[model samples]
Target chain A: MGSSSAPWKQLLLSSIEANSHLKHHSYFQLATVSSNNRPSNRTVVFRGFQDDGDKILINTDTRTRKINDLKHCPFTEICWYFMESWEQFRISGVVDVIDGTTPDPLKLEQREKSWFASSLRSRVQYVGASPGLPAVASEQSSQSPSLDPSIGPVAAFCLLLFDPHQVDYLNLKSNERLVFTSIASDSGKKLWTSQKVNP
Target chain B: MGSSSAPWKQLLLSSIEANSHLKHHSYFQLATVSSNNRPSNRTVVFRGFQDDGDKILINTDTRTRKINDLKHCPFTEICWYFMESWEQFRISGVVDVIDGTTPDPLKLEQREKSWFASSLRSRVQYVGASPGLPAVASEQSSQSPSLDPSIGPVAAFCLLLFDPHQVDYLNLKSNERLVFTSIASDSGKKLWTSQKVNP
Candidate 1:
């Protein structure tokens, strides 16, 4: 099976299950490129891991500049550094943006689920000007700023699926560094090719 | 002077001087782009501000991938997020790499100064694998790792000068977000054009 063959995948799975370092700090630094090739990065909350650790989940406001950047330049590197363990995972992947207004029922469910998970204050941010607009002193909206999930940007909070191309797991605590690239088996099942890389 | 007209520059200067929230947390997240436009990011320790806040400094190994990336794509956006104050500063700029091997006395002085400030363990990192090299179990080195200012990658430890193009300051505590752009003044003096950007 895909799960058994990949040692790197198992390591990531165990870390997620342990949840010591990753639970409290789900915010990973997300990097994206502008049209002119300038690198822009900011913090993004990790939603969850998908496909037995084959893919990762993150949500974004459809109006945010990063979502726009992803459309133009789809490749991104999301890095999560664990302070306690001193481990850093550099996951390089291409993204699939599940548009908020999509007619597909499966993606629609994801948007609704993401909205419910988001805090009232976070939901309020998406309904406002698309993220990077020039600031106004205080954006006064009579929209009541309700905590109700239905009242937020139910249509603007999009789902971004990060499908990994490669994962570089570095144990700064130790001298071991591993790189894993996803490949396929003879039977056409997806698997990983793991190797110890120079850190 | 360029410093007087720019309140944003003053704000950054004061923050650095006050050193409350930013003191121990000087590691700002650095984002860079590859030739193929894939965005990669990592955390970089802020060395200091230069040119009256027009430029900032950070030191890194010349053999690292980031320095290589900068050589091809000079534009970079550095982000410093103050967790305690709920303030974020996004600094976008080009880089000027001061090679450690420079014979110039002024450039050599910076390398020497930076070396003195670096910890013994940090100096060890420069001598190992040039960073990002595929790991070979435990890297065995017979040469004793020393804290001497002349030792390690003094030749490989490059000073990266980030010359600002623009700076976007956002206060999550308040709704105020401002973007400042660099411009030349009437007398060929470099100044900034401050604006109230939408947040």
Candidate 2:
């Protein structure tokens, strides 16, 4: 069974709804360990869940350093805070990068769909100069030509599928915390166990 | 030289001030690597800068898992987002844990001052059950006695000093990004170099 059947998904969905008013609610920090064993973190906009599963969707430029870090070590932690409710969800998982060269048919389709789901403005960013490179003065002033949405995700547009193994949910308002862990069952199914803990 | 003298400090301060109206601006996400090599992340309240330096101050219970992670690996990354300005500051640093057992007199003094700086309600949490433990019904309902403010930090109260070496500042509103790196001079002074990068 996919993580959609996981027990923590409901609580996560509810928390998202609770903080829907805030535009930044969908933004979260993703942490990964570089090859040198140093921790790196940055903010990424939540693209949405993949096919009703608990796997998170995050879009990024393939040229970014995080892509290289993920190649070295797929393990990652996502820290998402819901300001209105003062709730935090720390999800620990391994990320799978689905880029232009992805071989999986299903993943490629998902990546293509995600490309079209993005706003034209967001898609424009992928066609521009590579992220983290020194900005070119001439390119900065030039108007970005609109991307052909039908062409699918640009080479630079990469989709990260975060497959979570653990979710630590903390609600400050209730002064409660719960940890949900995913376990593989004898039938090769995914099962989640949750325990209430002190916040 | 302290991180306060770094060039990125000014931009960080301005972003913090721009979002001062939002109470949650003081909250940031901290990422660390566990001994097992997996990345761990959580939201941490920003206490303040240490003295006139950019050593970031954060408080946590000694019983928390983060303390163990720090003991195993001091390297950490702090991701702070300012919603109003649509800016993000990713700081890479090594963390110093200062608890009651700390031998450094000056470090212990800072920890004591940090303890007193916390609100009475916050101090009461240190006297309660250890965090991340299963909640006990009786213990959860009982009223927590006020902690003595005069007494120094409780054994559980720990201070974390984050000494930053690199800062990545991204401003989405202006579509600009800058990287600040700390370089040590031959005379032992810390100097910062910044480069404008594509967002």
Number of clashing residue pairs in every model? 12, 0
lDDT of 2 by residue, B1-199 (tens): 3443778888888988999998699999999999899899999999989888878999999999999999999999999999989999999999999999999999999998999899988998999898999988998888876777777789999999999999999998888899999878888767888888888
Clashing residue pairs in candidate 2 are: none
TM-score of each: 0.84, 0.96
> Model 2: runs farther than 4 Å from truth?
A1-4, B1-4
Q: Name the 10 consecutive residues with the lowest summed lDDT in model 2 chain B.
A: B1-10
TM-score of 1: 0.84
Q: Quick one: best lDDT, which candidate?
A: 2
lDDT of 1 by residue, B1-199 (tens): 3346455767775655554643345667788887766888777788876545566878888888887789889888887766556567888888878876667877677666666677777776666664666655555444535555556445677888888878888776666778888777698665777777656
**Candidate 2 - CAPRI tier?**
high
lDDT (10s digit) by residue, model 1, range A12-47:
655555545433356668889976667887777777
